[model samples]
Target: MYEQISHSLLNEILDELQPNAYERRRDLQHFYTRLGANFYAIHNLFERLYGQRDDFELQMQRLVETLVRKYMHRPRELKDLDIAREKDHNWFLSQKWVGMALYSAGFAGNLRNMAAKTPYFQELGINLVHIMPILKCPVGKSDGGYAVSNFREIDERIGTLEDLQTIADEFGKRDILLVLDVVVNHTSDEHEWAQKAIAGDKKYQDYYYIFDNREIPDMYEQSMPEIFPESSPGNFTWNETMQKWVMTVFHNYQWDLNYSNPAVFIEMIDVILFWINQGADIIRLDAVAFLWKKIGTTCQNEREAHLLLQLMKDCCQVVAPGALFIAEAIVAPVEIIKYFGEDAIIAKECEIAYNATFMALLWDAIATQNCKLLTQGLKSLPGKLERATWLNYVRCHDDIGLGYDDNDIRAAGYDPFAHRQFLIDFYTGSYPGSFASGVPFMRNDKTGDARISGSLASLAGLEKAAQSGNEQEIRIAIDKILLLHNLIMAFGGIPLLYYGDEIGTFNDYSYRDDHDKLGDSRWIHRPTIDWQRVELRKRQGTIEYTLFAALKKMIAIRKETTAFADFNNRHLIDTNNEHLFAFMRFDHNRSSKSVLVVSNFSAEPQTLDLQTLAHEGFGTSGQLIDLYSGQQPVIEEGRLPIQPFHFYWLSEY
Candidate 1:
């Protein structure tokens, strides 16, 4: 019955569409077929959220029209790519796909220059490059390009859209995947829609959550927590021009969209498709957790927000089935897994999501010199849908938030509050015997909460070691860096490397001198690439050369290891040594092909009893070889000793 209703509505929408679109639809019979298959689910989802509104049918027509237009705009090459991806739907799950996230301008001066430097990424065995947000945004007011003034236009400081197309073209030839950001939650006040809203245009005002007064805003503030307490103090900001209180969850200038309005949903869907047409293989939906707002709720990770994502994903499938979505939801482990969609097998919302739990747990292990909480946290993390995978990384273009579960912390034999405070102090160099040189960010005075910010090298103790000219300390830091990278590479997902971490770049304190960046400590890690420093990778014995060479080798080995593919084949091993984090990975098709990954997180050596893993075919193995170093671990008294900050990928042929 619902299918008939959806088809009837689609027919009406098709008839009302322009003649050009109709002609193009005939050329795209596949598009028509896909629309026919998915429109029912789309319609049901849309109606579920907006059926009570008077403009329900009209909004439905507009939504279908948006999908049709974008489908027509998609180039023939992209359509062909879509068809190819459809045939191999699980292509992204391959072990060969290693990713790196970076800013175009910061990495190579501009889009064109970045394209010219494609060999740099290829050299590091990176085939998935996530260029950070480059859309047009207000100068000085842009939250690092997340506050988009214009969705379609590229930021002038970066190159033009044509340059981005060039990147897509060039990267395509290299078989590289291009990932782009779509800031779906909010837009800059300088945007045309916001401008009209401020000018008292009723239609534009409906695009955002602009309230007449503070009555409803006050109700929302009661439940909603402040995101950036030190910088952006409140959830509501007063706009004097319209005498309205607007929802500014992140910052005052960035107005949150009213998802209750179907028009807003249609507009964002159009923006997403436009970028997909421009050559984004993967679209990272920014701040997906904050899409829906409700009174007496945290306004994050709501059910309606998941429905919105599902709708957006369905629309994209009809237009470009190959394009994958990455949910950038950095909430708790339980909440974050939902972004992968609540399906028994296949993911209905996003194909990929950030493994923030794993990332933060890695940091916790580094700080505490143990895997107690890391192991406990992994146990508590909900298993994702089979079709989805994790985007694992140590750091990105954001501050590190200790959003660990208190239960897991307690299970690890530590007080949650005191443990978190210790991590904060250790990273900021305030704790005794700390080697990290990170800075505190967005410290909430009321809640005694704060996040740490710094480059990976700085946080791993390279900065202090280099500053003090301690060669021994520098080697330890380098080992620590490699140890972190090794886990992510072998950790059942696509390991995302940040731009400068491969070459051991330190935090740039110069961000503090910039007027626009002074308030944000995250910018300290977003440093401009020193090509001169990058050149050091060619020189042996240099820190850059050592780190880059080791990482490149690991990436190559990871690509060759069939067991490294993400098929939910990872099993955590009980080592009984708190300093050792151990897990086993097996090829999903051939369980006999397996690797045992074990790492020592402490400064002191640790031993793993081979007897514990004897039942899993380890102690009686016929010559266990380390795939990483191609060496054999000497087992004495049924125990394997591991050096400080070292790891091994043990396998038996």
Candidate 2:
């Protein structure tokens, strides 16, 4: 790490530091040590990114100053927490942590009320809370708070920054982790920088991709696929005030930041550290794949983007080493793995990533009533870095895109295009005998592409069954709900539950009335929680009570299972039964502590041959216990019968 070039440059930069900064460094011994330890790698990455610029040294000096300022502003309690996390680096990779993602306003009224609902999370056994975006943005063009008009200020519609601090304080006392979002990809056109650009500030104009005419935009549009093809249609939106075109990959109001400029990179880094100082344990970088763009390429998953992420990570390490990052890149499996960094042993970029492929595959099994594609797709999922893990979930505040690979679809004995279309139709209730009540989102007319949007309960037939008043159908619907929860709970990662899924909350049709939300069908699943309906969770025989009790039991069991800790210890078993999906999770240190998870996706009873898992320590003579049920599985004649839409967490007793 102490290469001559990097060390010499570091020494030069240290000598050139201002008098106040030099004195501050002397007082902050730990900061000085961390900066020294990380400076070589930081310099190397920064040099790789901006080495050719004339103001390279100036930018390097600015980056270090930003780190020092943020470190100084970090609270004393957080500093102690950081040191503790540093001592226990792999603390997050534990079975004890369960996460729930919710909007502050939807879950409770605001940040203050959300803080008071700590008991609600505790009652459900959740210790990690991902409060979706609460930043200031334009009223109608917020894109669900993804478009930020002010990076440092909290939205007035929500509570103030002080209210957020209160939640952090209260959650810290209850030993809960707070995950916040940093929309790193773009900002609202109403942002200060964008306004300056509109005001003819040439320097600010350089911050975004502003064009004089359609020539450059036309060239870029050839390779850049439309994100919102139906609504936004194209990648470039013409600005009347500036008489120029700006690149708007998501929506016209969200202007993509030009990462080709080092200043822009430095500014975003400062913004990330700003949130870390605001008591965010983990920062989810939104739309990370589109960070760096090129004219001729797809402008996604570019090499420069990865380098920029690496640089941001190195800087974060220097200031807040304990704080973690979650990459929100929902791309292909191969490309998504790189967000964990290409390191062999350690995750240098992001410590966590959304297991989107697993999510999509789970839905595939639900629609097809088989695990063929789910098995094949997972087999194709690349192994993650040893230190990195996944954030497994059944649903979130977004639409589900069936981004399965064509080869995996073909291997599962289905046509790629036709299979995707079937999923769209089946979930939208357009296919025959389909019980799902999902709506279509972002349907591209030119390409015939679309995504599905609905709550887990609605998509699993609970809504339709309840409406039909069929007892048998309702029971099967609840079974399907628990079956999906069982898989994510035992899967090798921190299982994330959506806000109202625990009580089987249905899709809200009210979004159709709000003009801003009418166009986005994903809002159907982002329903406001009805406390009155939530009270039904305590009333016996109600659907809410049944779901809440089952999910709570599963979460408790998941925490107690030591093998559920994520260390890349899951093995996908070939059940050879199309209607059945099976996998084994084992503790890397103690292989004897293993659990075999088996689920039946069909409506008919299916038998699993015990001999198939004989090598997994389930022999004919031993007793096999289902951890969730706390009873011995009924295995007769070397076969275990699983009831329809049921699952078991079996272990040798």
Candidate 3:
């Protein structure tokens, strides 16, 4: 927009921006300038959303007013950091980030205790810690802390605000980033807004999608898939007090926030900035795919949802510039990439997104013990934006939904539905001769679509090994865990380890005894980290010692290596061994060396023809070095051999 024209609009909003209401200083001026730059996009969106209302301009005026007020309220230190970050725009794309996702209490008991574990993180080369939501929620009914009751308030059971501040400060001193969840799509029904809504407050009731009857909700449910079928079946829940039905996507307690309402968007935006200002470097926007809903649509990855995110990103840039966003949208591979946004190249959307496709591909490799599906899936994955990257992980607090592409499955010569059904059965031990001991989380009766939930160790075959007490099986299980970890570490993105996976923490069936938790199977994997088990990491022979030491080494290696970057430099290699998954990460400049990562998923020994690698430019001259084994390859004519369930991180000959 023309500077004069923007100035005219600014003149119009000057009363609301309240130039005198602020200190009328350089900071306020700079904020006003940013608002002017973003005003066009924000105005267009806000108006398109609420322009029909008589108070559309009033809401835009208020939103801009809120941004300026928040900027002025922002701490000076954070402001300085934001200024510095604006100067170094791509600062977040650095290779130094290594992440771990864990519950606040499960990891250390409280926020203060989590802060105390800063040294532990530093030791493990972790620079980003995604502490699962520590906000207030109903004790047992909470969806593992996701059913947020308040945005700004910390859960009293976790710790005080002071503890969070201390932890953020501690992490800052060491250059570690703190990542927190902002459950933007929903809030606990007991939240103040929900309570007001229950009391028949028309304004607050509009905060959620409330229908007088089930007619509309049932129509929406015709297309919307059930996230937790066995636990929170169906999308609508009856509210006796209001005598209406409300849409609850995940759980009955988690009332989906009405994004169609501009008020709700503004409030959530405030909540987002609230935490970013409070020292959350990266805010994980939880369940973002379900943010926008339309009656006839599946209500996943709606266009307005993307626009809302784009607006959120623009607004945040005007306020908390240093903060980053990780979109927690686990949709189809194609749909998942859009969370980064088409306008992402201009810093107009999320900085990072969960590489759910790659995650699902890795699991496919685990199940099929072949790279065909993984390779096919990788080929189909849309390239991520240059500025945005992926948060790669094998498991999180949520269940594993096989969100693979049907075309890829068909290309691999398997019936897509049957293959997925097979995976569900294999993981849940319903299929004969399956090694995995997982549970079916949300089994949708209508479509037979079920998500598997279990700890990494249990799902990876360690639990069964421990019961057998077979030395060979236990060793293989440990190798499989480390093997997956190695891929994530070297796969050119921020690798996030689910809290207890480092020490092979198996699923705990104890949650079945708790009334609130028994229904949610994902809780089986959210085990409390045992400090004693952690201590045994020093004792070489124990399971904890072996798994922890191996994982710690992988983390150290990843931190030291510069080749692991998330740019589009990866190439899938055909090793001709079904059990071995091989890929290469190349330097973008093409001058630097590339790393050949070969992961053997099977227990039996697997070999790849060194000749096959020669065609891919691995045989430039001398012997290739296996980073994990630390052994120089016996490349006679450049053919390197590998062991069973083993991997080699090879550089150029």
Query: Candidate 3: global Cα-lDDT?
Result: 0.84
TM-scores for every candidate against the unseen true structure: 0.98, 0.98, 0.96
Models ranked on TM-score: 1, 2, 3
Candidate 1 residue-wise lDDT, 121-235, digit = tens: 8999999999999999999999999999999999999989999999999999999999999999999999999999999999999999989988999999999999999999989
The TM-score, computed over Cα atoms with residue i paired to residue i, of candidate 3 is 0.96
Count of backbone clashes, every candidate in sequence: 0, 0, 2
Candidate order by lDDT, decreasing, is: 1, 2, 3
| Clash number for candidate 1 | 0
Model 2 ranges off by over 4 Å = 19-27
Query: Which segments of model 1 are wrong by more than 4 Å?
Result: 24-27, 619-621
Task: Point out the higher-scoring one by TM-score: 2 or 3.
Answer: 2
Worst 10 residues of 2 by lDDT: 19-28
lDDT of 3 by residue, 1-653 (tens): 44564456656887544456786566666676677777777777776777799887678777877787678788888888888888988777656778899998899998989888998888667889999989999887778888888888999999989999999899889988899999999999989999999999999999999999878988998899777777778899999999999999988888999988889999999889888888888999998888899988889999999989999998998898788999998888889888888864653668888887887788778877777888888888887887788888999898888988899999988999999999999999988888898999878878888888999999988999999998888988887788788888888778988888878899989989988788778889999888988888789799998987787778877665667866667888877766778888887756667888988776566677777876777756765776766778665444565666778788864
Local lDDT at 106 for model 3:
91
Q: Per-residue alpha-carbon lDDT of model 2 for 1-653, expressed as tens digits?
A: 56787778777876776757547444377777788887888898888888999999898888887887898888888888888888999899999999999999998988889988999899999999999999998988999999999999999999899999999999999999999999998999999999999999998888899999999999999999988888888898999999999999999999999988888999999999999999999999999999998999999999989988988898898788889999999999999999999889788899999999999999999999999999999999999998999999989999999999999999999999999999999999999999999999999877778999999999999999999999899999999989988988898988999999999999999999999999999999998999999999999999999999999989999999989999889998878899999999988779556789999999899999989887766554567899999999888898999999999998876
Alpha-carbon lDDT, every model: 0.94, 0.91, 0.84
